[model samples]
Target: MWGPSFSLRDRDRMLEGEWHTIRLASSKKEKVEEEGSMRVFMEHMKALEDKSIGFKFHTIANEECVDHYVVADETETGEYSVEYDGHNKFTLFDADPGAYAIFDLTNFKDGKSFNLVALYAREPDVSQEIKNKFEELREKHGIPKENMVDLTQAVGLIPERVLVPTLQIPVATLEKEETPDPPVLSGDFSPGLQHHPFLSTHHPATSSHI
Candidate 1:
């Protein structure tokens, strides 16, 4: 099936974030509808959308809106080879992550349209990391953990040269739970804040931010 591909354009870095665009590339192969492959790509993006909007507000807020990431177009390729069993197995693939660019279309109260930071393979090392201690903290504090690590890595397994549509996530109807903080014992001093440095501050604040 036809899909979309994106070419990364320019991006700007901010102290807090960045913005970039993936230029609309070409379309996928014409003869086959690789539904399984396309679905795999879609699921990967949906996972990202989920994490990006997981934050809770301190006070009551307006209805949460979703960020828009769409597929402008896509391109794909495939090949088949004879196996030792005297049968041919065909493998299909795509190169584009999406057509045009994936972006958040929300208009903020400030009247600015949502700006997106585009990341590409050739872009400088714009990636970040988080420490295991953050996971430890999540476990210790009884905070529900997100399986983002597994999800993000899974997206890479999708072959290239195809532009899957940008994944969409609705404003999740979050159950507001007043999670009480665990008791902090003042007397359990360990001389210094040994665990603070390894607190994994680099963890993604939201999935979209990744």
Candidate 2:
């Protein structure tokens, strides 16, 4: 089974909480219906960022929308856990044994330094420079590009806003009610695989803005 290996620098950059916006630039689709569904999925992500909303990626096994899981124990090689959440949701890796890439993007926003993460299943249809980087990693791992998916163009990042509430909601009141779970993918989702449920079209809407 092929898995993505990230350098220490790359891992640190991803764990850093400097990114604000994310976009879906591309995905893997085998049919016209899948393509349509992917478009809707991209639109939903855009809507979430526009509204400054956040989501959690549930990694528990057998749960719906469990697209990825974290290897709780690290190996002697110092490989961190393979997990995804609102913070590292864009960080891509194969939930199963497959080829993947863990890379970094350094950009300046408003004169402040920030980083973006791009995870690819296969080589992306990007510039020669970017392709070269992916190629180097592929060669190092001896993984063929044919087995990977080009998700580079399918996703992107934008600015994000941090909100700090002045007043805290009472814990007693909050605990009195149960919050509904995020929607799960119905038609195309695999039974045992982890999924990004926040990308579902059935996500709730809000009038709030960042």
Candidate 3:
């Protein structure tokens, strides 16, 4: 059985038990003109100015589900527990409504490769390349362009140092064991958020494992 959110078709390309590093290329935002204008605008924005993100996937329960982790940087980390339907797409429940990330695996002359592009429900700036790719995927999925947001503003510059967190799973016991609980985001799991325009807050403790 597959998870309600993910598809099985992407399993072959998105190998489990492996880690992939994603380097930011560019960032921009989309603007829509008047209803009849049919004109769209893209504005570039900066966040995570110099950071490298990390992703890791692990199949659980005979491939019925997956436990994934997103390491925003050395200080912040978020865990995603999702079901696998296919096509390397997994629904994220924790994001702000209508926001999710797609793990796209591309094959190049060098070999197979993978990258993640996030779709936000709100309006945010992103790069042209990312916007175009996002539009194509949105159309393929039959999602309305107006309902989607480009939240990849932090995906362009590479940081000097990158840190990938290790996964932590509960050990099995001989007796009947209770199901493991879903992973939770640490207090400092805010990605691409450095200085807030409204309120100032203190950074939280760093916890690597879920």
Candidate 4:
């Protein structure tokens, strides 16, 4: 019931292609957010083969969108060392491989560590069955419900973001997949871009040089 539990499910190419952020929760925030938009692209590098994953986060700020790249290398079954906003440890769990996935990430900045959980789906959203299991997993991890935001439900449910230093706001946009283009900041994920409070929430990585 303590420590981190990394799911050992076999998921070859499960993370490949595009994903939308359906839910995002941070212990430091109130309520799970359900009315924000952020898309992710995962590419499997066969040349790196079990070495790394091509990861990026597309976020909308103002009326414009920007892509931030992350350097990710597989260190364990469901664990990765990443670079974005400094260094981070990303862990995967409760993955459906084809439907959805929930992951925990701890990002180290300056001299502090920040942790949050996120739910990503292949479609605009996932089935209730997938969401139900994610809910269970969430409680199991002791993640406060108030600290998360669910984006798959009512847009009217959008809550004003809590005031926090260094936190950026996400625009109210529905999930949409687009063609992958070169990132505006590959391995250079400065908060200058649309930095989601939760990694609702996937940030970038820089295991090596940025």
The models' CA-based lDDT, in order, is 0.22, 0.30, 0.29, 0.55
Q: What digit string (tens of lDDT, one per residue) describes model 3 on residues 15-116?
A: 222222211111111211111110111122111222323343322222122233333222122222221221132332212122222332211223332223
For model 1, residues 1-210, the per-residue Cα lDDT tens digits are 112222111110111122222111111211011221111122122112221211111110121122223221111222222211122222111222222112211112233222111112122122332223223323433433331122233222222322122223234533455657998687666754345553212211122121
Over 4 Å off, model 3:
1-126, 152-210
**Backbone clashes in model 3:** 17
Candidates sorted by lDDT, best first: 4, 2, 3, 1
- Candidate 3, residue 134: lDDT: 50
Q: Pick the TM-score winner.
A: 4
Which segments of model 1 are wrong by more than 4 Å?
A: 1-15, 19-129, 143-149, 154-210
Candidate number that wins on lDDT, 1 or 2: 2
- Give the alpha carbon lDDT tens digit for every residue of 36-136 in model 2: 21121111111121212232222112111122112222234443222222111222222111223344323333444323333433222334554555555
Error of 2 at 143 (Å): 2.6
lDDT of 1: 0.22
Q: Write the per-residue lDDT of candidate 4 for residues 1-210, one digit (tens) a residue.
A: 112464322343546766667777665452233223322222221213555665655543332334555556766456777666567777776676566777777767789765567777777778888777667666766777776666665222112342232245443432354557985666756663256534333333323423
Runs of candidate 2 exceeding 4 Å displacement = 1-76, 83-126, 153-210
- Which candidate ranks first by lDDT, i.e. highest? 4
State model 4's lDDT: 0.55
